[model samples]
Target chain A: MKLWHSFLKEMKLSARGFYFYVEILVAVIILVMILFVVPENFRSVEDEYLFYDWPEGVFEEFVLPTLMEDDLDGKIESVEVEGDDILYPAQLIESEGTRYYIFESEEAVLRLTDLDRPKIGAIIRMDEQSQPYYEYYLQGYETQRLRNVYSIFHILDFDLMEAEFESQEVRSLTDGYLELSDRENIVPAMLTFNGSMMGVFIIAAYIFLDKQSGIIKAYAITASSVWQYLMSKVLVVLVSTILSTVIIVVPIMRLQPNYGILFVLLLASGLFSSTLGLVVASFYRNMMQAFGILYFLMIGLMLPAIAYFTPSWNPAWVQWIPTYPLIQAFKETILVNGDIGYVAWVSLGFFIASGILFVFANARYKKTLVS
Target chain B: MIKVSNLYHSYNKDEHYAVKDVSFEVEEGEIFGFLGPSGAGKSTTQNIMTGLLQLQKGNVTVAGYDVKTISNKMFNQIGMSFEESNVYSKLSAKENLEFYRKLFDVETRDPMELLRLVGLHDKADIRAGEFSKGMKHRLTFARSMINNPTLWFLDEPTTGLDPAIASEIKGIIREQNKKGVTIFLTTHNMYIADELCDRVAFIVDGELLLIDSPRNLKLQYGDKLVEVEYIKEGETIKESFSTIQKEDLDKLQEVIGKYEIQTMHTKEATLEEIFIKVTGRELV
Candidate 1:
């Protein structure tokens, strides 16, 4: 009951400050940006196709008709056919009785080109040895697009003309497409970067304000223990983080992640952040010094964000960061409904880290009070 | 209610003690003043007694519990108003008092009633941060009385208050003392100590110089003299003589027979003078 009273007092004091309203406003703004602005700004890149030196009637009879038949008109914005001159940016070009498709941009260009396969009634005039070049280009767009192109080729008996082709290739390509098309990876990454990182500043400010106001000393003389006081602060920050996470996740992603697991993960992250704040606030007597260290710590904690937005640049060492497992666990639960063994392990690591930090902070709190 | 013997404290190892072997006692229902200048270990000794600081080298007890082993239950019976106003600046006067009232298990005095006693009932809803220095001091005083503690520790209780408010606070202190509250006051203001304290301890450089009733200290340190003012030959003349000897009475009679005496008064030293005479240093 004393702990409850102390928690309520802490919450009431925090609510009266401007930082509380600013935090809520920031959460609402982030949700608003995610819902109303991000999609409009993140429009998918348009698919462009260039047909070089093709017959004038080929577009109308073959490419355009194939695109219409496949219901891909909206996917392929425009298919331009240029005569003899190779001035246009064409991925595929025909010259000297050879229908050749050149791979551009350091990789095979398969998804955006109209030359996925010749029309059903088109003549199979290309040499059989040119299949290697097609196979090389086929690797770029994953297996699903390859299968669709191959199925079109099969309709014209092009696969029969080439003995290297087999049905197993289609199955492998379908599997590859499933791997690349998973959209759930982005949600957890967003939650990790946006939801958990916010607790650092909120909890730090709470601790610093109380210390500055000398209220923490008052708590020391009261019936409440240091554990109860610190836990009350951690709980308040956890609730605020959860509220902000909900505001960002519910309307923006419409994702029904296993909330129980998500809440646990968020609480662990919040506790770690809160304990870290307590340690810093206890160590530094003023905000300027605490914020200086906080910025450095924030840079380290938010390193996982780089991995979230840009996966190619992610380094192996980033996995050692505390928030890394949190991000991975969130991705697993929200995307695949995977087992929580990793989450449990990372949660344990967080608990141990927070416990050590709490011990240190409590010692510092006592020392500061005495001084 | 409070006792200390050979109390010693220092902030650093083997350094000069901030409170060096300070010893004093306060009887129940007595207003005991710890008088010292800045850096005189007045606050250090008070903090040690209030359980805010650990006793380093001596025995100190408040309300029968050793200061080192004092618990929250003991803290409940001892209220402290620090030299610095430590009230929550963001909270209103009533809110600050009410918050502290709920911290103890005992039924506390009403927050409004305490505020009224401190003459702050009109500003009950104003945030304490917005209050002037004197008002903040009064609020702190009111906060100390919230628990109706038997042992009250007030450091510079009327430091920044106006004369009227200071008088009112002194009255409240006396009233609490009448109810058997032993107030442990620490201040450099000799006037306040002389007025309210039943007994005051003079300390300097963390050492006790003297401990006695203010009246007794004044009598011991002040000159036992009487002054007479008279008009002789249409001119005023002043004469002073030591009252402790018989010859002084003869001198007084001769002056009265020789001229018409206009005024006569006994000269008693102020507490500040006694403090300076005893310590050979100014209170500042």
Candidate 2:
């Protein structure tokens, strides 16, 4: 009951401050930006095609103009061309009254022909006994567009072709030009970075006020234990962050995520952020002194934001940060049907990290109060 | 009721003690004062007794609880007013008291009633941030009594107040004592100590120099002589003689018979003078 009263008092105090309202306003603005200001996703068909070994005149005069007329301008980022070595071994033979082209890759064999100028192009992946593993056909302009661009009759196992293309493009993409188009992916990342991480500054400012007013020392002598005090703070920030996240995400992103995972991840993130605020606030006597250091720490906490906006720039080392798993877990819950086991492990890691941070923060908070 | 025996404390390990070995006891309902200048460890001693600081050595007990091992439950029976006006500045005077009132399991006094006791009933709705220094100090005093605590620790309860408010606070202190509330008062104000404290201890350089009632201290350190001033032949002459000796009585009668006396007074030492004489340090 004492804890509950303390929590209510904390909330009332926070509500009176301008910072709390500003935080809510910022969350609303982010939601508005996500809902109305951010541009809509446009599917680029050319991204699915891998062009190879087309004559220069055919690409520039016929294919380019046709693609442009089809509103597919700049749709394909890059195209591969055949060089001195043949990328795919092919056998061309004349059959009973037509011609056939057979291409073989490591995984399967593809046989194609232009007999009777077939309007539809079929891609088939066949095994050793000529058993078809997978088959897809593109009719009308899609088939013509691909044929005119690459003169390819078939792709032997689309996965094999994709693997080759990805291996070549990975290096260029790593230079920081990857643009994510899915709202599910983008919205959760924004909410995690902009919404969750901002809790640090709010919690830090609250502690600074309490310290300045000498309420913290007063609380030290009360029936409320240090753990109860710290948890009350964490709970306030956690609830506020969750509310802002739900307000911004549900109506704007239109996503139906697994609430259990989302709740766990959001709670963990809020705990980490609030405790980090406590640690920072304990170091300074007032908010002004702490503000300078908090700005610097904001840079560290916003690494996930950089990863969210420019994913290719995200480094292997960023995973070492505790928020990184939080971002990944949010992405899995919102964007993709990710592995539940992976989410569980990441959530566990977050809980453990939060526990450690809470310990250090509690010690520092007590010391600051007594001193 | 409080007791201390050979209590010592230091901020750092093996460094000079902030509070050196000191011992004193306050009987139930007695108003005990710890008087010292800044850095004399007066506040440190109060903090230890209130369980705000750990006892580094020796033993100290407050209301039957050891200072070192007292739990938060002990705080319910004791209240403290810090030297600084530590009330929540953003909260109204009433809210500040009300907030603290709910911190204990025991039923606390009405915050408005406490405010009334501090003579702040008219300003109950005003935020403490806008209050003058004296007003804040009064609110702090009121906050300490919200729990109607059996024991109160008031540090410089009227440091910044005008004489009127200070006198009012002193009245409240006396009234609390009348109700059998043991108060551990710590202050550097000799006048307040002399007025309200039943017994006062003088501390200097982390050591206790003297502990006694104000009257007792004055009696112990005051001069035992009567000073006489008289005008003789257009010249004013002054003479002092020991009142304890029979020979001095003849000299006092001779002076009175010889010249017209202008004034005569006994030299009684103030607490300030006794403090300086005993500690060889001014109570700055």
Candidate 3:
């Protein structure tokens, strides 16, 4: 009965600080930024479904003219205006039915040829009387490719990325640019990863307030042992992590909706990162110091990618750091298109180990520094 | 109920002992006061007795339990209140009381009664963080009594408060004593110690200087003489008589019979004077 009373006391403290709310906000902000914003910027143009037509009796029919059409009826992926000066529409790449008009930008030049101007008139009689331009024009109709809807289901069986493309097979739609699209999706994921680290520090620092106010000691003085105190802290952190996941992961999941594996990853990764944060919080006297260390760790986490892609193997041991497990979990679950179950368990183990270490460290703090 | 012998403790051991060879004893159901200056090892001795610290070479026993054998049950048997309030600041007074009440297995009284005793019933649900120092001390007193402990240890129990409030706290301590609780008190405030303690001990520089009941010490050291003044034949006259002297009794009889004896009373020693006489110096 007393134990129940103590738990209520703890929940009261947690509720007052709204520690869980901050994490939920983190998750919401990240998922929204990724699924809502990044996709709009990088959407493939070919995902548009449109029908084209022209006056069959015009002196000249234009080869192609694109129109603007979006899910919201705003920025069409590609639009071509034809007149005395005719503009050829650029081709698009479609992923999950979202089309991005690659708009002949510098980056597009290296990835694609000048959106092959259709050679329809090359073998025919549509003349440059059309080249005189205004009266005669060439016309053709095509719509963007349909989004590869099945890519969502194949996310866990990531070998589809390397497997041969077989268009006759229902699963083959997950191949080709679909695989690259997920990797490209990771850029904003990196940014949100930064924001989540901020969330970890913001919430983890609250433990220091508990330490200073002697509430932790009050908890310690009870039949509540060291492990229980540590667990209470871990539970708060776990909630925060979940909220962050909801804010960041859910929306992204909605866009390239994972088949529940992402949820498992979200939970497992949240637990791991939160535990790592607790370990960081254990060593510092205050939140500002904890944040400084978190900033350093965030930088170190990104260091391996430099080596992950660089020629020298980057010779950096970034993956060996404590924060590496959660970052790697994100990469494996999201970017590398790997098995979510494998990464989830690995993340859980890391979380358990770090949590145990954090508990031991806090117990030591109580024993030595608390007085 | 509590005993200590040859207790030596040092914070910076290489420099000096905070408490050196301190020895004393408190009979069961007795109030024992420890009077000393700041840094004179009063608190160090108390902490060691409470098992918050390990004694270097002394055998200290509390409530028939060896001090070294500190178990969870022992904490329930003894209650302690420090000079500096250690109650949870953020929690309401009732919540703070509730939290400490669970630290032991003993069945405690209702915290509401404690609130009433400390004169804090109205503030029971108020946050302790906003309370003044005196209010916090009152809440701490309430917390100390929650477990209904047999051995009560209060360090500077009434260091702050208006006189009425301080007296109210003393009344509560007296009430606890009536119930046969052994209170081991430590304070530099001689007046509180004198009025409250059944037997008091003075210590200086970690050494015990004296121990006795307040009344007995005052009687032993105070001048046992009565001074009187009278106006006779339009002349003012004054005389002092030894109250303890046998021959002076007749002189007092004649003076009271023939002339009005103007204000005659026994001389008295204050607790401060007794402390100074015993320790050979003023309090810090």
On DockQ, the leading prediction is 2
| Docking level of model 2 | acceptable
Q: Candidates' TM-scores?
A: 0.79, 0.77, 0.67
* Per-candidate DockQ vs. reference: 0.31, 0.37, 0.17
> Candidate 1 has what TM-score?
0.79
Please give the interface root mean square deviation for model 3, in Å.
3.6
> Can you write out model 2's per-residue Cα lDDT over B1-284, one digit (the tens) per residue?
78899989988858699888899999999999899999999988887786566678989988888877767788888888877887878789998888888888888899988888888999999999899988998998888887778999989998889888888888998999899999989989898888888899999999988889999998899998899999989999988989899999898999889889999999888899999999999998
Q: What lDDT tens digits, residue by residue, belong to model 1 across residues B1-284?
A: 99899989888847689888877789998999999899998988887776656677999988988877766788678887766676778789998988888778787999999999998999999999899988888888888888889998888998888899889999999999999999989999999999999999999999999999999987888889988899999999888989988999888888878889999999999999998999998999
- Which pairs clash inside model 1? A143-A173
**Steric collisions counted per model:** 1, 0, 26
Q: How much does each candidate deviate at the interface, measured as C-alpha RMSD after superposition? A: 2.2, 1.8, 3.6
After superposition, which runs of candidate 3 have C-alpha atoms over 4 Å from their true positions?
A: A1-4, A18-231, A254-316, A333-337, A340-345, A348-352, A355-359, A362-366, B13-15, B54-57, B64-69, B225-259
Better of 1 and 2 by lDDT: 2
Better of 2 and 3 by lDDT: 2
Candidate order by TM-score, decreasing, is: 1, 2, 3
DockQ of 1: 0.31
Scored by TM against the true chain B, the candidates give 0.97, 0.93, 0.93
lDDT of 3 by residue, B167-206 (tens): 9999999999999999999999999998999999998888
DockQ, 0 to 1 scale, candidate 2: 0.37
